[model samples]
Target: MEGVMALMRPMPVSPKQGVTSPRTSVRRSTPCISTDFSKRNGCLIRAQQLDSTEASTTVPPPVSDSKDNALQLKEWEVGKLQEKVAASQGITIRRRPPTGPPQHYVGPFEFRIQSEGNTPRNILEEIIWHKDVELAQWKERKPLVSLKKALDVAPPTRDFIGALRAAQQRTGLPGLIAEVKKASPSRGVLREDFNPVEIAKAYEKGGAACLSVLTDEKFFQGSYENLAAIRDAGIKCPLLCKEFIVEAWQLFYARTKGADAVLLIASVLTDLDIKYMTKICKILGLAALVEVHTEREMDRVLGIEGIQLVGINNRDLETFTVDISNTRNLLDARRTKIIREKGIIVVGESGLFTPADIAYVQDAGVEAVLVGESLIKQPDPAEGIAKLFGKDISI
Candidate 1:
């Protein structure tokens, strides 16, 4: 033991013997995984002894989750992940916040999928994606034709189209577009008294330049009865048939339903579709409001010929994120040269609250707005229009 300590003292290799050989010294300093490392999941490694005079010390083993180590490990568990779960018991684990379903989106992008050991992603996402694609393929169908024809020949005096435009010009900013909804997808019931004629009268009194009547019965819970009611009610304001225009049958149906206008979503339709629909709208004496969300959609809307009204929607139809700035961004894209030449009517749609929001979009280049929530929430919807416009232009 004395000779061992003496040897280790000169160039210490072992604590007990202190035998100093170059090979042993080199081997001693090399990193070694604790024989008991895996026993406790890489914890409880006690340093035994060291010869003080040794030039080098043993390198600590790199932390790992490989089967080469003693601890039980999964193939997927590696890197920083191995550090997530501790070696000791009675200790809580901290996890990186989950990559859960998306909250809001700005544009189209593929979603991230997570699964255990890569078994396979659930079919639910695939199903939804397929449905989205199916909806995209519905481009072949056009619903604005016969409906336009019916509207053009509608008995309620086709000459009254000028009056509606005149009223919009007469009214100031955020010019009124009153809603005639029997029910909505959200609240279900809109007007319990639901008289289209009476409601039209009230809206007219309320100073509305146009009326939006939900005609989609499946979700919105509206009916053509309301459209006929308003049409026969002799309410002067032009009517926008709020229908899911998936098929051309809907447009013709809209004419029979007594609508003076229809919505054409740019996301759902290509430029050719918009041109065809807008042309149908003109032929049928209906005004078309080409609605867009993203810059791509705005560009698509602009490509359509004979487009007079372009609606920039804050509420996204797919994910339903309502960003008010969406309207301004789209409106700002319009060059002064194009706007003056086309004389485009820009309508800001949805998610408007205060007069400030109204004024914001109007200043952003919108001549009129299609407001629903703010006006509907009011005690007197007619008076709501007055509050929005800041003046009474009720006829």
Candidate 2:
């Protein structure tokens, strides 16, 4: 009688919640399964039913649940909004980061789908894309919030434009902005035995009005560490942080690193960014060198307010093609008249290697010349300076 009572009681079950009980027979395939709680028997109800034939072969789960689908839709919507924002800002070539449904975790086998803008069409586009990813990763490590605090303790900025004017007055030529470059995309490596501090000192001794230090690590093999070291080493020449700046954060970051001046590439930045960044530079007491390669860019930049210095780049960054004549061509009667009227100091940049090169740009009405490879590659960068001007400008 006790054994009969024991049989009436239910059997013990395992503590694991989602584990199914072992069964000898497979459940039959049902026509439909409703998740509505009202239809549930209030007891054991199967949420999923598998056929006996399908039991042996694995069946895949749904691609995504409603929650995941909703998230994907939100991400896509945000991406489109960002695109619109970029377009309105005059950033035609800029691309937003890829966003979509979260990828499924497949062990030991990774699957990835290429999206639009994931691959670049040209070298210029490639560099911009790479810069976006690099800058994003860098921001995570040294956020703008932290950089702003560092600015409070940063060193005072020097007179970059004044230095150029003074040097021109003393030399009767375009003031030299000697470049401390280790490498370039067009010319692979300028100096295999590159030493930033040493190069800076040589440039100073050579009587450079200012120094342009390449702060791009990936392509130029330069870093802010180099800029700081040169500043800390008692070099008095105003240091320019040469960088491919895409965001406003970099301007603040450059100030924190002891930069007196920063390069603004017109091709890579929108007119709005240049205008806003120029204001930020004034507030920070840093000089902004607004660089342009075409007539359209010059026209766009000239229209902006408070631009003090403008650089005419001889080298076409997009094509890597250079013609020093670009300087004379850009500063035609109309543009030169406007520049002179605005009191804007014109800087001739790139493709400058010799005294003739310097003279040519100066005749075209440039007050300064930013030189790199030819000066940096010399056995004695200081001697390279005297040769550059065809005379000893230091005296």
| TM-score of model 2 vs. true structure | 0.76
How well is each residue in 1-395 modelled by candidate 2, as lDDT tens digits?
Answer: 23322332434433233333222232322112111223222212122322334322211123344887555544444445544545665545544223212233323432222223233444565567667777888899998668878887999999999999999999888888999999987789989999999999999999999999989887789999999999999999999999988777788889989999999988777775687788778878999999998887888889998999999999987778999999999999999999999999999998898888988999999999999988998999999999988988774
Output the number of the TM-score-best candidate. 2
Q: Any runs in candidate 1 off by more than 4 Å, and if so which?
A: 1-153, 156-165, 186-193, 333-336
Predictions: Cα RMSD each: 24.5, 18.8
Tens digit of per-residue lDDT, candidate 1, span 1-395:
23222322322123223212122112222211211111213211122222333212322222345555322222113312322322121112111111111222323433222222111122222222332334444333433333445545565423323444676677655565677766654456755656667766777788777887876554456777888788887777788887555334455556666677887766555454466566555655677777777876776666666887777889866555688898777766445356657877777888787778888887887777777767766667778777776667676
lDDT of each: 0.55, 0.75
Q: Which candidate ranks first by lDDT, i.e. highest?
A: 2
Clashing pairs in 1: 8-12, 142-248, 143-248, 147-251, 147-252, 148-284
The TM-scores, one per candidate, come to 0.59, 0.76
Residue 46 lDDT, candidate 2, scale 0-100: 24
